[model samples]
Target: MLNLGTVLAFGALVLFGGWAVAAGVATRSLSAVNAVFLSYVASLTLVGGYVLSVRRPISGTGTDVAFALLSGAFLAIGSISFYAALERGSVAIVSAIAALYFVVPVVVGVLYFEADLSTANVAGIGLAIVAVVLIAS
Candidate 1:
């Protein structure tokens, strides 16, 4: 049976794939900066709702909190930059490159965290590289 994490991962894959397409469609007539602005407005509205409904304390060490904040800043920068790329590029190619974002964490995990570089994992990353190359052609 699939675990909750697996189920959630699949759900996210579908949801974000659809979101990417929608983002590209929405960007068709928008300026890159304007697209970023519209997206932030929508995102902030949801963040506000979640903040209002929070019931549990946000628990983390100072270092952990700093890392989280830093990561969030990178996420915003990447998301806004992606929207800018979508405004000027084909969704197919831009999304393919964006999908490779997974590689960063995987590589870092292997190098910094001593995460296992199993054959299967390496092969999967190789396949992803191939997919991106094919998508670009």
Candidate 2:
């Protein structure tokens, strides 16, 4: 049986998949920067409203706040680059290539966090490499 986290994650995947398709379609009419800007504005409003409704304290350590800002910077950069790529390239190819971003965190987890890579994880990484090569060619 799927746990709550797994169910929520699946829901997120479904929503994100729909968002990706909508983004690709919308980018045809809007510039990448504009699209990202508008999309994030909406994101902020919704998320901010949720926080307000929850009445949760927005407390975090200095380091946590700094890390969150840094993460947002990275996400903004990546989103702009991705949207730009989608503008100039085939959406299918661009998305497939972009989807390999999971490898970065996987590598960090293994190398820096001392996370173990089981046989299936290794096989998935190998298959991801092969998929990239096949897609790029």
Candidate 3:
């Protein structure tokens, strides 16, 4: 039987693949900045409301909120850059480059959270880097 981790990883892959497809479609229909802004607004509205209703108050310090906002700004910039890339390059190429985020998040996870990495994880990251090199070329 498939283990829980395998199932969850598959689910995440499916979700992110779907999101990338949707982002491509949105890029075709709207400006990237607008697309990102609208999507974030709608998602945050629902999620924030649910959190407020079901959980404790968001008691973050001002600095914490500012840092979160800064991170979001970077995300917005990245989305805009991606849309620009899609406009200039083939969707397949752009998508492949964007998928390099998988490797990035793994490195960031290890660095920021001191997450333990298995041999498989390192191999996966190496393969992803190779894929990016091939795709970019």
Candidate 4:
């Protein structure tokens, strides 16, 4: 049996990334604060339905709760800043630069969390940075 979970996740990311760029551009006409609020309201409404439909437990240990809250804070901050950046910068450049954020966690994981780093992983990280720099410049 083919698993649709992974496939759908990737598909959603691509679709939503495109939507984000377009939404940013559309929101560019408004002040960053106004745009962020509007986006948040829309997102919250949509997610409310999603939350209701998705059956999941919220129970977790202190560590897990802390991690979840931290992740949510960073995500909210990142999204708000990204929308603000889109108002002042080209969507292509801003999105490309923001996309490189994964590297931060990779470095953190390797340095503190005992994440295994093979030569290929290191090389890919280096190459990814170069690619983003080239694209941004």
Candidate 5:
């Protein structure tokens, strides 16, 4: 049976599939900083509303807070760089190169989290890397 987490993950995938296109199109009409700031505003409002509605506890340990802050920092850096690239470069190549961001999580999962992956998972990652290289080049 498909769980809520699985379903939400798939939904996120669908939503994100159009993100590069949206960014590319928007950057054509808007400055990169303006586009990114507008996105941040929307994301903050939506996510903040959802959290408030859920009434979920947001408190965490110091380590957890530090990690969250660090994650946000990295996200800000990446998003700014990506939107800037989109403003000046081909969306396809920029998005292709940005897709390599997943490698960080995969490596962290395997090393720190000790996540196990099947042979197929490994092959898929390898193929994704090759595809990005081919696409970007």
Candidate 6:
């Protein structure tokens, strides 16, 4: 029987694969900014409704709304840039380069959150960087 970690890993892989396929379809159908905006709005509607229904109201300073809007704006820009890269480069190359975002959270966790990285995780990070370099080259 598969372990919990293995099951979670498999699920993540499936989710990412599905996301890539859907993104490709979306890119083909509309401008990446449009695709991103529509998707974000839809997701916000669903997730926001669920949260409001299930969770107690938090104190919403204007800062909270500003932050959420800023995040959505950044996501839209990133998606547009990615779609543009895909147009100019091979999908495989663009995807491999884009995968470097995985490092962003790790770096933020270490630098800002003071999370400890195991030796194995450090090695994994090194390997990921090397893979990105090789794939981009």
Cα TM-score per model:
0.92, 0.92, 0.68, 0.86, 0.86, 0.67
Clashing pairs in 1: none
What are the per-residue Cα lDDT tens digits for candidate 4 across 44-125? 8998889888977678899999999999889788877888888888887888888888899998998999999999998998
Residue ranges of candidate 5 with Cα displaced over 4 Å: 116-119
Residue pairs of candidate 3 with colliding backbone atoms: none
TM-score of model 4 vs. true structure: 0.86
Residue-pair clashes, model 5: 0
Supply candidate 1's per-residue lDDT for 92. 96
| Model 3, runs deviating above 4 Å | 1-9, 60-67, 105-121
- Model 1 lDDT, full chain set: 0.90
Please state the error at residue 101 of candidate 6 in Å.
Answer: 1.0
TM-score of predicted model 2? Answer: 0.92
Per-residue alpha-carbon lDDT of model 6 for 1-137, expressed as tens digits?
99999999999888876765676677775776777677678878998999989987766789997988898787778877877675566677788888788798899899999999999999999999898899889
**lDDT sort, best first:** 5, 1, 2, 4, 3, 6
What TM-score, to 2 decimals, does candidate 3 have?
Answer: 0.68
- Worst window of 10 by summed lDDT in candidate 6: 83-92
Error of 1 at 57 (Å): 2.6
Compared with the true structure, all predictions reach lDDT values of 0.90, 0.88, 0.81, 0.83, 0.91, 0.80
Best by lDDT: 5
* Candidate 4: residue pairs that collide: none
After superposing all C-alphas onto the true structure, candidate 6 shows an RMSD in angstroms of: 3.7
- For model 2, the local distance difference test gives 0.88
